[model samples]
Target chain A: MLKNITLGQYFPGNSLIHRIDARFKLILTALFIAMVFCAKTPAGYGLIAAFLIFVVADSRIPPRLILKSLRSILIFIVFTAVLNVFFTKGETVLFSWRFLTVSREGIVFAVSMVLRIVFLIVGTSMLTYTTSPILLTDAIEALFSPLKKLRFPVHELAMMMSIALRFIPTLIEETDKIMSAQKSRGADFESGNLFRRVKSFIPLLIPLFVSAFRRADELATAMESRCYRGGDGRTRYRVMRSAARDWVALGAAAALTAGVVVLRIFGL
Target chain B: MEILRAEHITHIYSPKTPFEQKALDDVSFSVSPGELVGVIGHTGSGKSTLISHFNGLLRPTSGKVFVEGEDIWAQPKQIRRFRFRVGLVFQFPEYQLFEETVEKDIAFGPKNMGLSAEETAERVREAARSVGLDESLLEKSPFELSGGQKRRVAIAGVIAMRPRLLVLDEPAAGLDPRGRDEIFDTVRAYLASGENAAVVVSHSMDDVARTASRIVVLDRGRVALEGSPAEVFSHRDVIESTGLRLPFVTRVMHRLRDRGFAADVSVRDLDEAADALLRLKGGGGRA
Candidate 1:
């Protein structure tokens, strides 16, 4: 079947990082990504790596599983690396073959770019790994509560977002099952031409969409029966709160960002 | 005559991951030819997992599955042939129906079996007739049909393949009593000829008693018991302790036997029980 599926890959644990507010995490991840671009040297990238390792360790998810997530993106890393390696111009060339020249700077540039991507995926994965989608949506809604003042349907938007997020795994599982079912019925997907491949997706996608909407209908009915009145004064099962640990984590992120900025200033 | 046999099969989901679960732990069973076997288990007892292995849809984590004494996984790429040999009607298979017309949907399986278009059409009609679907409905889109009709259409799709073995996961689930009876009626006729065998994975003891020649009870992914309906149903105390109820007629008959009456322990049908009661009443002059 369709392995390598990481949708809503929540890692349940009683760790400090897992207990942190997901909204803060989402924001901090954005800030951390922005800071990755600010790093100008190997030492600065080292800081980012250290920070990622610290966060990952604090989340308490086994390294083996996180490495499994990284495996799928290996091809993307190589693709990005090759693009950067071939595109970067430098006066110093390490090797030249035909029209292709491998530069010392280009190799370093590719390695750094690939490292950035690896960190980017792993860092974002932390949010999903620690927080379930429902709790994450509630935190997002609560964090963006001020948007309600601007006539934005914060609750409705969060509800829609949560529903969409929730269905990612469900739809993936459904697509996998339908694909296998069709495969058993001799709907060839692998040994087909480009046109045939696209055509093959018709059977999979149509059934997937049909089942998804069907599930949505059933879920809405279930929710209505349970009296799921939207975010209008409706309390959550688990309230979003920022505890002392959240401040500590945020403080560490701020410090890391400041250190990176200083390093960029020095170009060291 | 044993068409399907899973020897020492074990399956684990999300293995080595934090959420790892042993769905089927060393479960083994064999289905003899023309035998209607009922598989019953509590939720998460690996009943669904077990049926998936019958048709090579799933491979065991360890151990072997043989279809008619041939290793289904001998050539990994040839697993599709095994699927055609064993038709599996997955739970809620109706949701998998995507063809524009009922005829096309029913033809899907037979066509997948590499049958000629004419042969596929013939099977489509035959299967539809077997399930009591009208020929006029063949032109209608499967989605437009009622839920039970769509269910039968999905079932007909699999049956049209004419697999040597048929495995259905809860065929009569969510159906009205009449709809349930109609399904079992078709299954009974299909099994009457003893040309093929079918396995029904269900939790309803009464339904199993009414339809299956034998029952295979599963507890925690192990085959707790596998025997003819009468032999398995005789262990009412063990069945009850596993959170499974005995067949309705069997419970009634058991109570009568407790009262020093020679009520037949094999009576699982209402009519049969009624007939037995009448005979007992006449012999005892209680009429």
Candidate 2:
């Protein structure tokens, strides 16, 4: 059952998006997130939507995959929408009930909040879908290289994040194995009261935590045996370089920001 | 009566996705009561997947699993009951040990069956004894036990339920020879109780040949071979084609026969081969 999780999962593709430099894609993703939040007017949202659609189409990633990632945080999205719909007070009321109010402004606010969240998630997912975890971490370490002057452990932090991301699937698969093991022993994780169900998870959680620590210890030993002593003096085999396509991607991000800024300034 | 049967089982993993692959295809088998069936296959040959179907842990894309003549998936809700009837000890089952104490871990299954505390404790002690775990060690935490002890505890947890059909997926995997022998002995004794059957999934042909009465060979999700151990070992070429080999003794017997020595080539283990060779020697080396 845990296999359905698609969070941070990378899809292999040979499209322009996949070929673009990881550093450029990362920067554009952050810029896209900012532009989505800055979109307050219908024209701004329409522009962002168009750009996202164009990116999705060009990337060639299956739309179903993008939608699957959204499934994980769907509850959060619905909650935010409902909160905005029922609680945001406005001068123009659409419907009123005892202690519950739905206003025209509330409807717009709810729709915008949901749209912003959806766009933010899809935009970030596009970045991960196109870039492999190793490349993504390399790009992050390179982006943070400037902070080395501040005496920060930028490389170490990036290594840690990458390791964590790399093990997400492994840990998930382990969890599934442990769950099935416990299930075969007559541990019922489903069809129980809330309390009983929570109690049943003890069999699964303890073993998962134990195995995770064991894995971490093994990984540490394996690394140490290979003479890994932090990122100092470590040279990468693959160097990140900006290609012509990367420059075009940067320009596209700039154009998106400009569009959002123009729509805000014109009050469209 | 047949304790378990899988009919034309076909399991396609992540169907309709890029990861789509057939883990099992058109496989059928049955385990009768008191039979020890050893399932041997190369990695990813669907041995684990087929065993998972016996207890309804996995649903086949197109097939049916029957436990005690009733379709496990017919009701769906009562599939949990089949779990108690068909206990599956996963690969490296030591990782499944979770209860605070060894005693409690072994009792977990019976408790889940809603047995009274007295009955659960009795079953726990019996299960521990069956696995050769000392009564003195039951009070200690499972974490305090050695690796072999921990695995036995996990096995005892399932055995306490007294499942009519026990399915073990590489129970002796990642263990020393002594540890593997201990586990194999315990499982053999457990099946000797006359009320239960067993299906052991193993890559170790020697271990399976020594323990199981029947051997089922899976090659790429299909039943490549199935028969008594002697019968299956007789066809060493077919078994080896699936990236598996007959037990060492069986191979020795085959070589002896090929060398024109009057020897029975159907020996399953070292003891049987030794007896057959001694008999041939006593008979003046003639068949």
Candidate 3:
């Protein structure tokens, strides 16, 4: 049951989006997020939605999987929508009851807010679904290389992130094993009240934490024994290079953002 | 009466996904009381998946599991009761130890069964004693023990629940020879009551042959062979083709027979092999 997490999971493909340089994809995703927030007019939202749908189609990731990613945050989306619908005071009231009001403007605001969140999630997930975690971290390190001049440990931070990402599946498998072990001994994590259910996880969590620490320590030892000294004097085997497709993708994203800004400026 | 019975059980993992796999397929098996059933299969041959069904850990995609003539999954809400009846000690179970003290860890299972504090303590002590753990070591942290000792503690944790049928997956894996012998000995002692049964899953033919009263060979999710050690080991070609070797003693006896010595190639254990050799010597060594 713990295997359903699909957020930030990469799907390997050779589509145009997958082949684009990870650095460019990262920039494009940020630009898309910024543009989504700037979308105040219906025309701007429509443009953003069309661009997202196009990106999702071009990436070739299964629609079911993309929808599954959204399912994880469905509660957050519903909560925000409800908050905006009942709390945003407006001139035209659509519905009213004791201590609650839903106005025409409130409904519109809620729809736009939900759209913004959905677009933001889909846009960022497109980046992760196309680029492998290793390449994503590499892109982050490259994009933030300027921070090195400020004496920041960008390389170390990136290395840590890549390692953590690599171990997620391993730790998840370990948790499954440990959970089954506990369950076989009559540890009921499914039944009981909320407190009791959470209490049952003690047997599961302590062992999981212990195993995680043990794994981390062994990994560190293994790395040091193999003469792995941080990012100092490191050389790259797969250098990131911009291709024509990458340039075109970036230009399209920039143009989309500018168009949204222009539409907002014209009050469309 | 059969302690456990699996009827045409088939399990498919992640069904409909690209990673879909049939881990078990139309396998029917049963264990009578006072039987030590050894399940031998290469890795991913569905040995682990089969044992998980004994306790309702993994519901079969297309079959039923009965514990003592009652369908285990008949009442899904009460599945935890079957877990108490059929305890499972997982592979590398030592990693599951979490309580502060060995005593508490051993009592974890019995406590989960909702036994009184006194009964839990009694079972804990009995389990610790059965596993050859000292009373003095019970107070120390399980993490402070050696790998073999920690494994024993983990086993005791399950045994303390007093399951009628105990299933262990690769219980002696990665242990020294003596440690392996100790683990098998403990498991054998647990079945001395003549009212309990066990299914020891392992790839080591020698360990299973030494203890198992009956052997079941699984290959590609199907039951390839099932019989006593003598009956199963006689099919050397079938066993070898399944990517498993005969017991060490059986292989040695076969080699002796190949070398022109009139030895019983069906010998499944060291004692049988020794007795066969003595008879061969008495019969002038060659046919």
Candidate 4:
């Protein structure tokens, strides 16, 4: 059941979006998020939505997977939407029952809020879905390399991040194995009072933590045996280089942000 | 009467996902009282998945599992009870040990069953004895124990429950020859009561050939071959095709047979092979 976590999952494809430089994609994603927040009018949202749809299609990732990513946050979206619909005070009342009010403006606010959150998640997920974790971390290290001049451990941080990302699936598999082992011993993780259910996880957690520590210790030894010394003077096998497509993608993102800012200034 | 049975069990992992796989397919297996069944398979032959169903750790996608004549999943709420009835010692069980003391680790299974404190302690002692763990070591922390001792403690934890059917997955893996023999001996002794049965899952045919009354060879999630050790090992071609080999002595005997000598090709272990060779030497030259 732990395998259902689809966050940060990457789909490999030779599409135009996948071919874009990882660093540029990261910057473009940040720009898109800022532009999404800048969108205030319906026309602004429409423009950003159209851009996102086009990017999603070009990414060549299956639509079903993108929809699946949205499912994880469906509850949060609905909760916020409900809160906005019932609590926001507005001039044009659409429905009223006792203290709970659903006004025309409230409905519009709820829709806009939902759209903003959806765009934010979809846009960020697009970045992850297109770029591999290793490339993403490489881009992060590249973007933050200037911090090294301020005595920051940029390479060390990147190494730790890549290692953590590498072990997610391994740790997940270990968790599943330990859960099954404990379950065979008649440890019930399902169907109990809240305290009882939580208490059951003690057996599961203790073993998981033990195994994780053992694995980390072994990994450290293996790295040391190979003369790994904290990413000092490390040479890249695949150096990051931006191409014409990457520059065009960044230009489009800049243009979209400019358009949204213009729309906000005009109050359109 | 059969102690455990799986009828046409089929299991699919991560169904409908890109990583979807059919781990087991239309496999029927059963173990009777006083029987030791060996399930032999190479890696990814569905040996682990098949045994998981015997104790209701996993529900088959399209089949049924019966523990002592009752469908285990019939009352989903009571599946834990079935787990207690069918004790499973997972692969490399040493890594599963977590209790502070060896004694407490052994008692974990029985305590979960809600046994009285005295009963649980008594069972712990018996299990420790069965696995050859000393009472003096019980008070010591499990983490302080050696690898083999920790493995024994983990096995004793399941044995403390005294399940009617005990299933061990690759119990002898990653052990020296003596350690492997000790584990098999403990498994054999567990069946001395005549009321309990056990299933040993292993990729090594030699580990199970001597003790298993019957062997089931799994290949790509299907039961490729099933019979007594002598009966199954006789089909050398089929066993090899499944990515498994015959017991070492059996292969030797087969070699002798191929060289025009009258040797018992069914001999499973070294001692049996020695006796067959001695008899052949006494019987003049070739058959």
Model 4 vs truth, CA RMSD: 2.2
lDDT of each: 0.85, 0.91, 0.93, 0.93
| TM-scores of the candidates in the order shown | 0.90, 0.90, 0.92, 0.94
Question: For model 4 chain A, where is the 10-residue window of minimal lDDT?
Answer: A1-10
Candidate 2, residue B228: lDDT: 90
Clashes of each: 0, 0, 0, 0
Quality of model 4 by C-alpha lDDT: 0.93
Q: Which is superior by TM-score, 1 or 3?
A: 3
What's the true lDDT of residue A100 in model 2? 98
What DockQ results for candidate 1? 0.48
Ranking 2 against 4 by lDDT, winner: 4
Worst 10 residues of 3 chain B by lDDT: B262-271
TM-score of chain B of 4: 0.98
- What DockQ does each candidate score versus the true complex, computed on alpha carbons? 0.48, 0.76, 0.78, 0.74
Better of 1 and 4 by DockQ: 4
Chain A fold similarity by TM-score, each prediction: 0.85, 0.88, 0.93, 0.94
